[model samples]
Target: MMKVHNRPQNRCFFLFFHRNGQNIGFAMPVIFSSEDGKCFIMEFCIYPEFRGNGTGKECARALLHWAREHGALYAELNYGGDERRCHFWESVGFVENGSDAWGEPLMILPPTEDVPITVEILSDPEDWQLMKLENGFKREIGENALTGEKQKQLQQAVKQGKITFFIARRGYRAVGMCSAAKCYSTFSCWDTAVFEDFYIEPVFRGKGIARKLAKAAQTWCAENGMSSLTVCCAPCDENMYQSLGFDVRLGTTFAHLE
Candidate 1:
């Protein structure tokens, strides 16, 4: 099952990888979900002589590009949990997310376009917006932790401008969000912002929504003349924050949740 040698001819599209007029390899891709714009890589091969030396990587990128041109919003492939294979695919922008029905690990590369997703700083949000925010809190605090009182407090905070939420939406549905809260900084004698409550719906992740949310929050801070923007994140998430221009390392933070 690792490779489908006998793919259905009518459903598969074959592609050849070439350089300098010489064929290097071939790939077979199937448009599995036309409506959702999803493609599955049925098979791929590189001639034994041309297996390494960056040839495979180059071909993989080209194949994905071709998939996108064919109207695929996402590309998927199944691979085992081999470290080398994982590293190779991840290097080319594929993220190992879940497993197929057969338990084969599935990897995906999200859509290329970051548009059609609008990020806005909300001063007056509708009921759907409040529901989405509550959904984020439910995920973070676990089931039943989002009590009625807590929901009311969150809505009140947003209404009073005690917190600002940057909501990312796909059409009318809210897909992701991040919030910022301002605090007076005695040391700088100015107000500063701490970004928090970053959340994206699981299915909509890896499509650059997080970056959009972060950018919106950062821009709002600048426009409002806040002195600085900071986030307290776990060591594992340091790289994610740093990538979004939070490069200055402030000392580690310890919190008492109670």
Candidate 2:
């Protein structure tokens, strides 16, 4: 019989797969972090005799399902920059997002297949969202975007409903984000919003995530009774905005105070 066990002190568990009372494979050091709802798959192995014809994939699928069922929001592992290994994990629905604190390459797998890229309005900025937004800003603007104090201020503003934050999530990770600043339009005599800081991580770009974020923001404006949503785009981005149903009516320029 196959035996299962857990090490509560270390928050680690082991899963063994067997057939006909013969051991086939095992996943060890399956660590769970309740603080972040992340499951860490440290090591997975199949016996030499059973290492063929989809056995590994099958075991991996089972392991992931178990992880999700046991309160794992997502699963992640380090792949050590191996192309073959990465491809194998990709086939099992893992995406190479970023690396770990140790600088090792990492991949993330969402809990289930139905958790497609989703965009949601952020009423409160969580740690994950703040981290992803910081990364997005650094990539797009070449500098840090939200510092701790700034984030505190932003949290208060978000709670007060002074602005809205839209985040695109691919499972447990925040892959993209944008914000809308509420304002009043004298011309329209109604409340309006200006969309800003739209960005998706480079790994997640070109997947229509940008459009989804924009659409969510637009929908929020409509549902909240705003007269319109506006975006000030550079000349290069004009076509992209047009594709998202934005019309160019005037040329504008800006100057930064010294």
Candidate 3:
């Protein structure tokens, strides 16, 4: 049996097996973010033959420890909305987000009305400005818990192809921004955060600036080959998202740890 080690910065893991090993297994760490700097797991898996050998649990624990060591405030995982995986995640202390594979209860925003707003993909040089605006947006939306380092990590994720950022403007001022990343399954959008600063500017409130921005985001996703979209919001903002044609998925859970 040959030994191989592959660990990428974006991925955290230790794989061991033969070059021609049958039923090869994997136990890797999955990382994601919340409104704050906390980390979460969108999914984790091992080969079927290796499931009952206690490898999964060990890997999960190791991953949790890694997250804690990295200063994550909390860790999360989403299981298939089935009896088996659901029970396993619960036993490991993960709660459901009342969402299933589609991550329903997910917010969906409607298309904008071809208004005067201009939307464009953000450039690298603009990251500093984007970060500044995003921080203000986070504060306004009560997501001020994110540390500057974590915010930088988020920006890095975007630059590394792990995420995408879009901005909407009306002349020289940026009115809104949307951050989205490819979902785990390769055909959907997940964790779409429409930053708060993007909300209708005081002078532009109630005129559907957000709707336009969101619509542009959807268009971008679809054009880029994403078949579905999903976004999560606080309970307080559910109505607004629902009004945009997003269906709320039930039975999933969401929690924050201090």
Candidate 4:
């Protein structure tokens, strides 16, 4: 369904477009009442099944085009409470400005380019300090160091060829990590890999670091002769995974008894 509607009284307009016969989400385009009027996005959702196929980006480009055509004094959008939700805004050239009417955070999308990211496999002893720093940010950790045994265990795993941990860095500091382990998959009848701890610190969430780490992991998998790699993420992270060439799968959950 594709429709364009407006409320002349409130000066609000919406543009809805759904593709692939999936009528699951909404896309809102911005408009203004006058040349000096401001434009703000409410929210635009691309259904899970349709994400990462340029649908979201296409909608965002269209919204910006409409805003430009209407001579919007400025384009604004709510970033919601989580900055992760603002990744698309950042990718679309939006930067934090102020807040929208509902007190939700807002950003302005000026024409710009993506930021460069650097990722590498962790091998140096000094890099372990950065790993501990990253772990300190975990909720259960609260700035405390990992157990000494735990630290040694991970080191042994690295030495035994059991796991590979890739880290993303900003100059001298480690910003995030994605750890992978070789494993067997029954369906594939071959060796596969499992990835976990694909985390980016809150400060680094929207800078395309995740994609860089994923690329490193994919390269490692290709070289290691693995059939495939499995990554599990919160539903919120699906777009990042999809852009890295992952097929998102849905499933029921079960707990194992000890």
lDDT of 4 by residue, 180-213 (tens): 8998888888989987767665545777787888
For residues 14-115, write the lDDT of model 2, one tens digit per residue: 679987898899886454453446788888889999987998899898998888788777788888879988998999999876544334566777454445
RMSD for each of the candidates? 11.3, 7.2, 18.7, 17.7
Q: TM-scores across all candidates?
A: 0.54, 0.59, 0.45, 0.49
Model 4: lowest-lDDT 10 consecutive positions: 136-145
Q: Between which residue pairs do clashes occur in model 4?
A: 94-109
lDDT of 3 by residue, 1-258 (tens): 112123333343443332245534544343323222235454466666666766666666666666667655455444434677766665666653322122221111112233376777777723554654565455455564346677668767777877677776654445467766665452333333222234433334566766777777678777877655566677887888777655655434577989
Output the lDDT of residue 87, model 1.
87
Query: What lDDT does each candidate get?
Result: 0.76, 0.75, 0.53, 0.65
Model 2: per-residue Cα lDDT at residue 255: 73
Worst window of 10 by summed lDDT in candidate 1: 1-10
Off by over 4 Å in 1: 1-115, 140-145
Give the candidate number with the greatest lDDT. Answer: 1
Better of 1 and 2 by TM-score: 2
Worst 10 residues of 3 by lDDT: 102-111
Ranking by TM-score: 2, 1, 4, 3
